[model samples]
Target: MAIVLRYVDSLDFVKERFIGIVHVKDTSSLTLRNAINEVLTSNKLSFSQIRGQGYDGASNMRGEFNGLKALILQENDTAFYVHCFAHQLQLVVVAVVKKYDGVSDFFEQISLVVNVVCASCKRKDLLREQARERVQKGLCSGDLETGRGLNQVTTLVRAGETRWGSHFNTLISLMKLFVDVLVVLDFVKEEGGSLANRQQASGILAYFKSYEFVFYLHTMYDILHLTGTLSKQLQRKDLDILEAASMVRGTMEALQSFRNIGFAIILPKICNLQNIGIDLVKQAPQLLEYMAALSPCDSFAQFDKSKLLKLGKLYKYDFDDSDMIDLEGQLGIFYHSCIKDERFTSLKGISDLSRLMVSTGKHRDRKCRKMFSKLKLLKTDLRNKIGDEFLNDALLCNVETEALTKVEDEKVMERFEKMYAQRGQI
Candidate 1:
């Protein structure tokens, strides 16, 4: 387990600092809790100091009764939990969509076809030759414009399962070179040197020509296009929670709109969408709501004083009753102070607002969201599937297993001995 702390400094500027890492025996909640306490004790930080927890939507981390979130909350009730935003995005678009057999099979066949076409020098050359001929035909028919560097032909890029961009590019390349890909597959099927190669080509050709594949290809292309912008924005280092929420809401609206019109247009072939994004929430609703209430968009048009006060109440250890009482009045004064002040006129996010508050001597105040991209990068497009520790891997340097075991053995084993009540088992 790794921890990246999002905390305010003396200057009240929000900072993300990489913190301690613990490689536990396993990811069970009890083990995680022990590891967490071990890190906190080493740093002289306390359980009471934790005001929030965010993890990806793994059952081990976010499970209602036994997750790490629940385990921590049991020790300290103030440590509320929220699911990771980017993981929620992948849930809605990539992971959920692939649950459908047609969509699943579509991607499977695409991988097979790309592999076959790029298997050797001769077959790859055939693809480029076909693509060149396609551009030539398009140019002659007035379907494509001549340009200095516009029509350069290239081989198809195979989609990587972990990259939405790669999947999108594969869809675009397939659409552009649909006829060309078909030609290559046909030649291999009829005149290939090996029977196994011919059989594979024949099966792929049959699958590609099926109505199911074509529908899935075009449908996923549109859905991915709709989601592409939000996905990029979510990964941006500068993105704050408020802007992310807005973009997420916008993406959901786009998806809903697409469903309304897209299904209407293709109502006749709408049988296989049973498992695509059945219950996707952009993120935990409570998290979005709490964060959304703190937005400074449109000169604090969305700011809710009551909700902002609730934030302080959420972290009561950091804010007492006097602070809360003072906060209620401060909220009103800050709103006008910011509105009348020209320095805060163009502010559209919480991070910018936090910084402005500090610069203007409102410093006695504070507080997050861009590290999920780092988490995603750790998942790496090469993995067969993203494991539960994707969040843990991002924030801390990997500890050498031998050193980690030796370094933390006493504390961990002592804790386990106390918990298990069998001292001699060690």
Candidate 2:
């Protein structure tokens, strides 16, 4: 199990730190809980510190009664559960596509094309070479502009079940390389090759040139474009729940507006959707109250003192009687000060207000993020197939690279020697 610690520091910045990974022999709620306890105990943290839970929509992880989410809530009720926004959007994409058989078949065809074109290094190289030549010719003929980031090639990216955003990337790259893909498929169809390969390529070439495929292609492009923005925003570290909620609302409205147009326009658009994050709020009244009160939107326009005070009482362990006495006055002053301050005025939305608040020295001190970008190296295709223990070791070293640099080389060598010496004997 991979553990991450997200907490607000004394400075009030929300920080997410990748805690070390824990190995589990099984994934029962109890077993998972114990693994969690072990990680926290080793780190000298406790259950009472948990403020929220986020996981993908997995039955074992987010199950209502016996899942790990419920088990944790049993220990800390204040630690509310939240389904991952990106995962929810991915589910939306999966479901919305299935609503129409045409859309479903479109994606299936896309997957098949990706598989056939990317089947071998020779084919991949052929596609790249063809795309490169086409772009070069266009650039020379003034049909394409050249710049630092413009007119660049889009390498075809195959979509996968594990990477939800892969569909978006695949759609875009394939759109850019549509001509190149057709050329590659045609070559495979007519080339001196096995009979089965020839037949499959010939069929794919025919599909690529069809009117139905083109219709579904543009339709999904528009739909995924809107949802893709939401997915990227949801994964941002600096983004808060309030900002995300607003973004989700905006995206849903845009999608609905797109749907409301006649079928002629809707031919290249999508319909059917569901409101997200509503259930989590419905499950916990305190959560609803907290989000309502904590919104620093409209220059503290939504600040509610009574609900905030109620939230304080709900999490009594974190707020003492003395703190409680002072919180109300502080909340009042904070709200008014933000309203009067020019720095807070003309802000775009909640995220801007959140950054301004954290910048002020008056807020609590919270240790937060700057290391997550380094985490991407561990998940790239070439680096993904790694064991948990080694993954954690790499994470620890990467997260604290400066600290690792300060350690003596001899000490590192001694540990490595000890680890490998036994292997050598075996």
Q: Which candidate has the top score in TM-score?
A: 2
Q: Clashes in candidate 1: how many?
A: 0
Q: Per-residue lDDT for 127 in model 1?
A: 89
Best by lDDT: 1
**Cα lDDT, all candidates:** 0.74, 0.73
TM-score: model 2 vs. ground truth:
0.75
Per-residue CA lDDT of model 2 for 1-426, tens digit only, reads 667787765555456667776889997888999999888888898888887787777788999999999999988987878777777777766765676677778888899889888888888999999999999999899999888998775678988875557888899899899889888898888882688888888888889778777776776676677777878887886776667777776876776665565235645443332221121111223465466666655666677889888878767667788878888888877777877888877775544556666787545521112344656777678877887778888888887665578999888777877775555632
What range of 10 consecutive residues in model 1 has the weakest lDDT sum?
394-403
Estimate TM-scores for all models. Answer: 0.74, 0.75
lDDT of 1 by residue, 93-132 (tens): 6666555667777788888989888888998898889888
lDDT of 2: 0.73
